[model samples]
Target: MSGAAGGALAGKRVMVPETRELEVLARMLERHGAEALRCPLVAIIDAPDPAPIEAWLRRFIATPPDDLILLTGEGLSRLQGVAQRAGIEDGFLAALRGVRRIVRGPKPQARLRAVGLGADLSAAEPTTAGVIETLRAEDLHGRRVGVQLYPDNPNAALLDFLRGAGAMPDPILPYAYASKEDDARVLAMLEDMAAGRVDLAVFTSTPQVRRLSQLAVPDRLRAALAATRIAAVGPVVGQALEAAGARVAVMPEDSFHMKPMVNAILAAIGTPGSGEAA
Candidate 1:
């Protein structure tokens, strides 16, 4: 969609943390006439070791699980890339076709479609709790469930729930977060927020919040965040921000993607007494 000259976000400065779709988000914000303040916070990279991932793929091909839980589209894509490089893409896809695919959100569902597949079940709310709630009614006793996990998050709650339900939880990590080398950039962004230079700070992932909390002192981070309005892409990210001691001022009511998030920003800014820049 073309942004109007008098767009809703005209003259707004929105802080966007680094993510796989950084440019996509930045362009979307800029299209609406907002200045996207790009800050590098976290980087995603292929798993440092591929042997375990290949082993998991081989095992999966040998004995297709009864259910598969895909958390992020990135994890699935990374696994597919590894399978392709190992000359086992066909086997992997074939095995995948035999399983009941469960997805946490729309991203994994979209990735499934990319591979000529679809989700058999989707979480009701796109969060870990949502996934558990969706599967609460399923007969998981002694069932083999393969879970695709992202970097740094162990997701103990999901695993424990699966075990409690008598399912064999097989988890794999296909990607990892890069080391924190962008501390300076994050610090600069924090500085900008503290100085009231940023109109809104947008976060799309939990890791970004963690990174910011890690680099800045707690009181300082909270103080800096208080200077700007915070928008989280969804409830999960919103919870993380809150847990980190920042108040979330904007979030989409239904959808949690970037486009919906932009609309939320617009809606918040257009509201009377929303504290947006004049």
Candidate 2:
């Protein structure tokens, strides 16, 4: 895992906009001989109030939904954490088991498996549209679908799609994002991007793109990003960058994760056939 030997990303300066996995990602990049600039623009935390989540769990325990959709593994873990705090861990797990489960991606699927549960349906692509398209193939007429959501993104399209297909949609948002506007370090990072000091910019979530735009000024950020090699973790993140008018130059070919994304970044920088930096 050491980059003392020859590595594809040797001596590259890479910008990482991650919060929870900041140290892990930084270590991974450093292992590949890359100078990892750790800048987190947004911080995700459990919702200040747990009343809504508690209500959802109570209703779920009373009458489980016909289908449960998990969008993020973080949301699932957060739900369990809240349930444990409320002393309803066993009940909540039982209620979840009563209904069919659907996962948007491998992360949530892995989370379910960790809890001895499995997804009844899984999206081929790890995006909101992918979840909708995957569910469209099934018959959800008059069925109740409970959706687990993460911070910042509401994913209204999925709910609209479910309603259009004659299914009732219930959303449970367990987390919320608080901007790191007060952090002086973020301003320095923005200045670095503006000066083209960062060689490559890596994004794991759409909110990271929004946070950068908010802090760096969208037009200025867009201009600065033009010269930077932007690497999105997956299509959803790529779309977010593209929507913000940033050119996304790299993404994973198959699985969407930190290691795969690092390899994708290496490939984009002319190091084709490079494996995980770890």
- On residues 112-139, what C-alpha lDDT tens digit does candidate 2 reach at each position? 9999999989997888888988888999
Measured by TM-score, the strongest candidate is 1
Error in Å for residue 259 of model 1:
0.9
User: Model 1, 83: alpha-carbon shift in Å?
Assistant: 0.4
Off-target runs (Cα >4 Å) in candidate 2 are 1-6, 181-183, 270-274
TM-score quality measure for candidate 2: 0.93
- TM-score of each model, in listed order: 0.94, 0.93
For model 1, residues 1-278, the per-residue Cα lDDT tens digits are 33335556777888889578888988887777778887857888999899999999999999999999999999999999999999999999999999999999999999999999999999999999999999999999999999998877899999999999999999999999864446777788798899999999989999999888888999889988899999999999999999998899999998788888877887887434333222
Choose the strongest candidate by lDDT. 1
